[model samples]
Target: MVSVGDDAPDFTAPLADGDVGSFTLSEHLEEAPIVLAFFPAAFTGTCTTEMCTFRDQMANFEDVGATVYGISIDTPFTLNEFREQNELNFGLLSDTNREVIDAYDISMDFADLGVRNVAKRAVFVVDGSGTVTYTWVSDDPGVEPDYDEVAEAADAASE
Candidate 1:
């Protein structure tokens, strides 16, 4: 996994912003700090709870001058549906090819679940300079990151 102080891997992928645009991490990094919440899939119970938590606390993230994104291996189409269904306020990114997932070392094999190359539950805070400031990778798929700690990391990154 990419550790704290390591430069965040640059990636450009389709965004679930209900448009034909793509999101480039390096480009966004040039502007402000970023909070990346990587989930295994969209619409799952844990994923929904985690995303809604981010949505509910989006103002805090904005107050700290940070951009928030929820990423998954789901396609943009599916993510668009999930976003609309959940009323998510932030962008959901599609890492369908798992390129970014692999680069971040968050991929897991869910053979029992009949899925492969899915991302593990993880969170990463990247400063404006593109250095990873904080990371949390859950060993259990059902576990969620500490939202308070993630917000604190984002605040620290802004500073």
Candidate 2:
């Protein structure tokens, strides 16, 4: 697993916001501190609440010029709908290929649901230099990260 001070693994994936676009992590690096929030799936109860909480707390991230992206195994179309429904200001990255999850070492399996290669609930704050500044990962999908803690990490990364 990636730790603080480790170089954040860069990857490119589909961006699902209002439009179907592509996002390259390396391209966004150096522009601002980046928050990569990886969730198991979209439209689920815990995922919805977690994402909505981030949506509501977006100003804290924006104040420090940090960019946030939620990642999941869902396709761009599903993520676009999820974004619109939740009114999420940040873009959602579609990791249908599971490359990002694999690279970050946050892949989880939901054997109960028969789902495989889902992203475990994890958050990574990457500074402008593309080095990880903070990380929070939970094996239990029901658990969410501390928003204030993540905001502080992003603020520190901005400096």
Q: Which candidate ranks first by lDDT, i.e. highest?
A: 2
Steric clashes per prediction: 0, 0
Cα lDDT of candidate 1 equals 0.92
TM-scores for candidates 1 onward, in order: 0.97, 0.98
**For each candidate, what is the lDDT?**
0.92, 0.95
Once superposed on the true structure, which residue ranges of model 1 sit more than 4 Å away at CA? Answer: none
TM-score of 2: 0.98
Give the lDDT of residue 110 in candidate 1. Answer: 82
Whole-model lDDT, model 2: 0.95
Residue 146 error for model 2, in Å? 0.3
Which regions of candidate 2 are displaced past 4 Å? none
